[model samples]
Structures are given as C-alpha cells and as structure tokens.
Target: MGRTKPPRLDGESEDDYYMRLIQKLANEKLALFARYQMEQQQEEEERKEVATNLLSLKKSKKSSLKRKQRDFDEDDVIDIKIKNKKKKKVGVTTTNKAEQRPVVVNKVTEGVKEFIKNKMKGSDLKLLIQKTLYASDLNPGQNRLNMPANQLETNANDFLTADEMRKLTDKDKKSGLEVDKDKKSGVEVGILGPNLRMYDRMLELKIWDMPCTKNYVLISNWYNFVKEHYNFLKKGTLIQVWAFRLNEQLCLALVCPDHEDDNVAFEENLHDGENDDVAVAASASEV
Candidate 1:
C-alpha cells in the first residue's frame, strides 16, 4: 500500500461536479435577478420625482423692467444651412436678402410616444438613445450625444406646456405672414394645434429662454408651426446633459441655428448664387 493514503477520492464523481455547477449557476441567476429588481425600483422612484417637478412649475405674474439680453446680438445674421452639400452650393443662403423664413418639422415614432406615456426621465432617456445611436454608430457631434443642433433644441422643447405653446406662438402670428394659401415651393410648417392660436405662448418662451433675438422669427415659426400641441416633459436638455452627463449626452445638446452666426453671413450674393441653380435644376427635373 502506497503511503499516498486513501488517494484523493480518485476523481470527483461526474454527477457531484455537475450538481455543484448547477448550484453555482442558480446563485448567479438569483443575484442578477435581484440586481434587475433593484434597478427597476430605483427608476420608478426617479419617474415619480420627474412628474412632481414638472407639475409644480408655475409662472407667477410679476412686473418686468429690464429685459434679458438675447444670445444673438443686434448685428448677428441668421443663415440657412441645408444638410446636403450639393444643396449647400445651391440652396443654402448667406445674405439676409430673399426674406428667409424658418421651417419646422416634428415626428416621433409610435413606439417612442408610447414609452413616454408610461413615465420616463433623463437617465432612462439616456439609455434609450444610447441603445439607438450605438446600433446606428452615429455621433451627433459636439451637441449632446452627437445629435443635430436643431434636434437638440427640439428635444429640449419637449418640456413646453400648453400655456407655453400659446405664449411662444403669439409672436409668429404677429410677425409672419398668414399665407392662407401656401406658395408652390415656400416655407412649410407643421405645428401643435390646427389653429394659429397656440403660437403666442411659444413666442414668449423662445423670445426669452432660447437666447437668440436677432435671428428672424424662423426659429419661432419652426418650433410653433411644427407641433400639434406641446406637452410638458421634464427631462434634462441637451445643454443640461452636456453639463451633467460629463458630456456623454453631447449628441443631444449640439444645435445649429437655422443660419450662420451673426458675424459670418454665408455671402448669399458672393457668387451669382445657387438659388438660380436650384430653380434651373428643379425645372429640368420636372420636365
């Protein structure tokens, strides 16, 4: 008999090894389940808080004297930037001539709207957007989460209430032409309510909160004209996310004003200009 002794039980019985593995797997699964439950509970608590904050926001009447300085200065010029490079040569305008107008477009996936109805917040939204952009591999650029500058502003507008809408839109009603009959190829708009009534509140908000004053009413027209009706949603804005998310939400915050900054106008007349080129191309295509 070798002094090696009762020899380590030879080898672990295959069944015994399998039983131990099964136990380990069960414990891991239970831990994961517990973690998920905890996360859900935490999100529910956050949602409750978001709802309370938005509902509690109220505008108290006050006497006003000094008006807030708008982000854009008196000499600032607004310029239109068509996303397409080809259009840039032809459609993008640099000069303040031609009476530029702003256009607004708003569309939400049926799936997304459904998600909001249930309750959501900035953190949850951050996850949802991450899941989306990750799959697309698209970076919205310096704006939060690499989103388009305009889209950044649009997302922030999700915070607007009905009264806000009315206040915002009023200015456009006063400033823009009614255009009961749309021109063949002119500015088109989709807005919150069917009637023009909602714009007053929208005007007030934009004129104040949005930071640009010298830029024509195009921004206002775009925001107000595109909504069916504004609903209040309390989420950190693209700006808020930029400052808070350590710039992770960069895509959500970057916004392009419909036009260039006040200092550099695109030089609409520098060349014979592309407006003529667009007209020629469009005519040729129609033909």
Candidate 2:
C-alpha cells in the first residue's frame, strides 16, 4: 500500500473506452467506402463493355447491308444479260411460224339460227356463251351446265326478261327462282340440241352465287339432256349457246360443230313431247 500509485479515476477510464469505440467505428466506415468505390468501378467497366458490343453490332449490320446491295446489283445485271440473250434468239422465223398458224373464227352456225327462227318460232337470237366443255360439264354426277359470270357475253342479260333478271339477281330468293302458288322453283326454260329439236323435258335456270364469283347454271332434266348427247358432249368439245324466246319463254339452243352433221338425222319435232311441262326441281349443289 505505501508503494501503490494513485488509482486511475473512473471518468478517465470511461473517456479512454469511448475513444477506442470511436476509432473502431471510423475503421468500419473506411472499409464500407472502399467497397462502394470498388462496386462503382466494376459497374463502369460493365457499361464500357456494353457500349463496345453495340458498336460492333452496328458495324456488322452495315457490312451485311452492303453485301445485300452488291448481291442485288449482281442479280439485276444477270437479269439484263438474260433478257438480251432472249432478244438475240428471237428472229423473223419465229414470227413467221406464228403467222402461218390458221386463225380460228368463232361464229354461230346458221343451223342454230334457223332452228330458232323456223323450228322454235323464237326470235331475238343472241350468242350467250362459247366455251369448251370441261370434265365437270360432262360428268354424270355433275348433271348441269355452268355459265361462268366472266365468260358470259356482254349482252347476256339482254336475253333475260325483267322478271327473269329479278329471279336471278335477287338475294332474297334462296334458289334464285320464283316460287309461286304451284311451288315452281326456277325459270322454266327449254334447251334445244344441235339437232334443232327441243329437249324432251324442261330445264331450270338459276344463279349460283359464290364468294368470289357468280354462275348461271342449267339444272333440272340436265342429266337427261347430257345423257342423250353423251357421245358429243364430252370434255374439250367446243359448243355455242344461243338464247332466244319462244312464246315469251326462255329457250337456249346448243350448237356443236363437231356433231352438227351427226344430229341432223336425229331431229325431232320442236313442239313434241313434254316441252310445256314444269321442269323437275333439282338442287344446284348436285352439279
């Protein structure tokens, strides 16, 4: 106890402990600041790398565009060369060969007109359509004649009466035919064969309205007409159809030059058989 030094004061010891705590906090703050700086530096490097990649992509795109332009120019040059070669190959001989081919004139036969005037006592003979029969036309399953709207003559509608036109163009009628008290489905029309004889049975005239186009079809007893003329009504047979009126009724005359002579001996009376009867009502979809 004689040699003991004076005891340290409590205030001084507390002050020393506080100073040590402050120094520890300052060390922790410095470490946190250094970590933040390192993170910011890494982010800057990442940004620089992204900018470089974008620049490289732009350069590649420009090169690809130039390559495409060069390829397109080469293709144009090739096309021009081919055209010049074709022009050189074409000569007067080719034109003369084309000119030497016989020109085919499309005209209605006189017999058809005589049939309309003398036999049927029908007038206003007008060419309706001239077409080569297709497989569909000759097919027994499709027993109807299709008159394409585009192929119809400019005055095709001139043959139709006002009532007939209404029946064909009217959207209200489902079958494009006038329904009367007798339950008639379509216009009662007669089809005259190349032999100048009226069809044994009546036929129906209706319009088939499609999404892209419209067609006037002959149905109802068409199968019988086709069956009777099956020998000459085959596919690829060119035929002319003329429209005329008989007793104010619509009549169509079919003319086939190939079978004109063959059918001459098979002529029947124009007013014979069931020509006055109502046509058998058939669905247009059957064709």
Q: Identify the runs in model 2 with alpha carbons over 4 angstroms from their true place.
A: 1-108, 173-185, 260-263, 266-287
lDDT of 1 by residue, 23-64 (tens): 766965764553344334333433443343334432232435
lDDT of each: 0.26, 0.57
Q: How close to the true structure is residue 5 of candidate 1, measured as C-alpha lDDT?
A: 22
lDDT per residue (tens digit) for residues 1-287 in model 2: 56333454566786776676677669657645533443343334334434544455556675535553434333354355344534542111111122121322332376557546764457878877776676566555555687756566645568888888776655435775433311223677877776555666778887654323355778778878988877767877878788887657677878776564456333443334443322211111112
Query: Poorest 10 consecutive residues of model 2 by lDDT?
Result: 90-99
TM-score of each: 0.18, 0.51
